[model samples]
Target: MADMPDRTGPVDPPGPLARLLHEALTRLPADRASAGLLLAVSGGPDSLALLLAAAELRAAGRLAQVHVATVDHALRPESAAEAIEVACISNALGLSHTVLKWRRDGPLAGNLPAEARAARYALLAREARRVGAGALLTAHHLDDQTETHLLAKARGAAGAAGAALAAMRPWRDLEPGLVLVRPFLSVRKAALVEAVRGQGIAAVDDPSNRDLRFARARLRAELSCQPDQAQLLQALDDAQAQRACEDAALAERIERLTRVGHLSISPLGEFELGRSEPVDVSILSRAVTAVGGGAYPSPRGALESLVHRVRNESDGTATLGGAQVTWSKTSLHLRREYGRNGPPDLVWPAGASQACFDARFDVEAGAEPIARLVPYGRWGRGPLGHRTLPIGVNEAGAIVAAHPALRWKQGETPPALAVCSRVGWRLCADLAIEARSVLTGRPQNAANRGEPVGKGVADTYIRGQVEAACVARREVARAHFQDG
Candidate 1:
């Protein structure tokens, strides 16, 4: 990759990224409440190019609004230093910026790569909310998409073309608050690298990227060396287009098969004589999720398996989805899987009546909203107490769910019961601990509730407590449900 030919243009770097970005944003999501966008800039080739291009667009009046963000994983001793450098570069470029620091030592996400990605979006979304941004953009180029497609293919993803990963997604699945715009998906890695070089810039290389044990680094290297890789990339584009068609058809079918107020029906003997089409199982699952007022949250394999199970399910039963899923004669029930005890009943601190689960929702006491917040997503109320919700398609900036909402918060701590109050005060009281827990998933005892832990401990304590709450919420997890 270091030896790849340099192809850079000051105006438009030659590749699909430019095309994708220009094409995708022609019409951003139709949110009247959308705030300025937040761009993810790593000082790396991909993101640096993104920042530069975005600034240029804004200057030329192409992009009306946007900002910049660089996340410091801080995995290495020098990570912070590198981030500071990135901040310096961004400032020189006259872009608004912020650095999200990540801890090296933490309870490992099942896959380190997956965890890191999650942490990045979580951090990015968090910052976006703070700045009143509606969406968080990324610099994932065509090459990244190609690699993603291949990886998905390697994992046997059938419905969608495996390597068409660079497709512009409306939002991140985990963080639906922000739209994840990947304008450079069409551009090659060589192009971005060259763009950075042409600018006389140096990009940071994470040591983890060099470790071949990871699939991404390996695929990247392999694709870079393959003959006629250009043609292969073209094929992926075509496949992605095909998948788009199938997904559209499936979306329509699923919409028809499903209706609000009715549980999903498992039609048996429906496939016996081919009298009726199976309706792509993948689409069916996604449709079912939509009925719940939720987007797809199942992992690739889990979702695939669930689709299969539901389609081929007999009179018997099965289970699947984000939490606990049970298949019965009645319907396929998808819910969150909890730790020890199941859901604890409603117990908002002493002040509240019925509680609101999703941060996107608001609770009004009198003429004004008692609770007006969206963590990593968006937050800001109008003068009339009307909210111009800064909404994107996925989860991005999320602060924290109310702790009293946590079944565990009901015990005896003095300040632990402050669930439905102001967001700023509760967050300051627990951020250090939460940031720590973001790295390491350590357990925090409830006996010492309301007390903050060391810098690196919040990831665990908060996550555990939150996870408990998520599951408990599942007992009553009605997706997209809101109160008047």
Candidate 2:
């Protein structure tokens, strides 16, 4: 919450700079600045301005506390000296600064700019992890995103580059929880240079920016001379719009023919389908997002390939976006595709209000059951929402549905769970939350007075096996009576 200075001060909001910066800040993941962050400061205009602004923000005490650092690629003999000068300037600004240096070479050596940039990030990530920083913020402004849009458009269709450089993302925001923000992604580089100079700041230039060997640098030069910012921004919007339109159409079709729930998919093929008629990839991705709980699974190409395989071949499945899906005539079977490892081990506090999982179940005890704790196989990737179960406690905390269960009322609060544990962690980590009830003491629906409560292998497997057999025998009896 950085407060604006007195109205007499030259700085103001609602201006282009504030407009862009405001948008970028809000778009940042979690939007919380740390005690200090590691900033990727190049001596160039974009990064230099970013650092100065970050310093001002720190002084304002609104954004996260930050320290500045520059990575000297050392491609040029002057790189180290320039980085040193930059650090000195940063120090005078009352910001702690450091310069990291690394050497690059070989076949990959020729592409050292990109390679070194990546190496520098690895160093930063390791440092952030060790130091426990919330994130590393870099400045990639509007002009950069526009330039990228042009380059990607020239190379392929609308989705060629992916979602318009999210307002921030020179660094990945997904992993390390490092929020790569480009608050200036929409700000003009000229304005940035002006911001730097407005406070009398010196800037550095990268000679490689003029190199023709790189395609982006070349397009950047060509675009730098373009005065039509409105036209360019409009074109990108249109490109994005076109992409969304196409994806939406395809996604809609997929959604209609498909059923999607959190952690499950029915008729998954429609989502990955190529354009047969009016195919929308956008809607399909939306469905994927809904089920994934914000986890990005496979990319566009992988999704398309999976859909193709399911249709062209028999008995085939493909793994995408961390889920395995198989096609069947009856329905598409989708599940959390786990390997030897899965989601990082996480702790779920009891009474958690909102919980997401593979399959969620509940139990209660009453004359007319309020909720049913059923097996995962019984429900196809969904819960019988707004329902309740019967009250009959088992050995491993599982309450059985006493009277033709699977239906519960609102009064059945303070529910318990019936989970499959012998199967291992697969069913355990999935948990309970923010759940409340009227029950104060554990009720006894036990077979014997001293019997231990909560369900165990005996109730889940052994007793379940017998119950299944009884169900089977009833079907047989009905068949015999009909034949007779």
Candidate 3:
């Protein structure tokens, strides 16, 4: 027999995992050519495979800096040890690694798993920020997607059409400046395990994965006995595609109907509302959430009721998602309900880079710590009305600067403040810059406009005016600091 092909001389060129990862990275919305990525590793086969694939990409100069982090929830006695082992393996691969621990010194409450997952992401996000990574990568694969779909279906959240079975997306914005990417959503667990083994990496098996007490584990066991696995996965894919198309259309309609500012002003009469309740509800829900500055949209049942009330009542105000919704003959208006959802007082110390007052304004302070942000509504009616959602920084309990055009104390200037209806406009600005860069086919640093992307020409024009005022305030702050 011909001397069996020299077993493993140089190993095979980038495997399936590496190729898939390269393709996924190329599709990321943001510019990753010079950016770093933080991988949330669990020392499991899936994460180990991701690390191995990422290492390959880095070595080939197809990727940038790669960092690894293992979050130890500390629920299990073996978890700490597993994290240490993961760190060791990561370091051996010539990657920087950190182990984040979730410290729990009190009794657990409802949904321990859900709480732990939230803490895990928060820790991951903090670490990603500290390391200057633009995105966080997770090892959620095809098996996890199937498990999620089955779980959603069982929970009655999947709807009659099984729309919830669409599963997780490849990318999501976890927060501003931090994106969560799941590159292996389409890859299988078996493939991941094989990839890890190919790299000579030993992965740890968590007992929790097999514990029948967990819903996912129970579902996995149930799925193992099913013979229509391929068919189920294909159906899920089709459902996901249909859901994507519907969501895209809804977003486009919202973009046209909704306006972002102190209020999510919309002209409902312009659209044919009688036959499009679902679309109308979606638009109103998004607008309420955007204007209310809430972390999440209102519950579906409550939102549908609100839509019915808005459409039926010709002239009245109702509260939904902490926003006051008012409708008249031709238009609908939604604004923050100050009594129910007003922002807390913010302390802006001297020399602070930036501070957000409510989710509506981005306030930047100069080198001096001499301002406190107070709600404009708190000061009663002044030259600027309460409708502005104005925020003014006070020095020694006296108003110095109020946003949407107001500056007191002629000689004493205040810190710079940029107003936006929601913090999401910053994300939009980043995307806009990224799109421009992609369209121009040039590597360009994202521009920092420090202003909101308003919904219409009027809103845009007002933002421009506020931005100019902020620039003047910055100059005043600089000059004041210099004189002192």
lDDT of 3: 0.60
Tens digit of per-residue lDDT, candidate 3, span 1-484: 1111122223346666676666555555433222668899998999988887777766665566679999999888999999998887777667899999887758889887889998898788778766767668888977788888777778786664454567776665564456677767766677678767655667888888889888888888888787467676766666666555555555445444333211222211011122222327666665566556566768888988887877777667787766677776566656566773355777773344555565555555544443677765675543322533545555667665556454445775554455433333421222223232222222222221111111121222221122122223323333332212
- What are the RMSDs of all candidates, in order? 17.3, 21.9, 13.9
- lDDT by residue (1-484, candidate 2, tens digit) is 1222232223333344443343344332222223446677888878877776666554544444466778877777889988987887777667777777664434464565567766787566545544445457677765676777776667564555444421223223412223344455445566677766665666777788888788878888888687666666656555444444443344334434433321222221112322233323343344344333233434777666665665556556655654455654333444444433333321221222211232211122333232222232232322322111122333454443332323445675333333211111111111110110001011111111221111121223221122122224323433332212
lDDT (10s digit) by residue, model 1, range 108-204: 6578777788778767766765665655678776567678777867766645444234233322322222345555554556667776776677887
Ranking by lDDT: 3, 1, 2
Ranking by TM-score: 3, 1, 2
* TM-score of every candidate relative to the true structure: 0.57, 0.53, 0.70
> Where is model 3 poorest over a 10-residue stretch in terms of lDDT?
448-457
Off by over 4 Å in 3: 1-13, 30-34, 160-162, 255-279, 339-484
Better of 1 and 3 by TM-score: 3
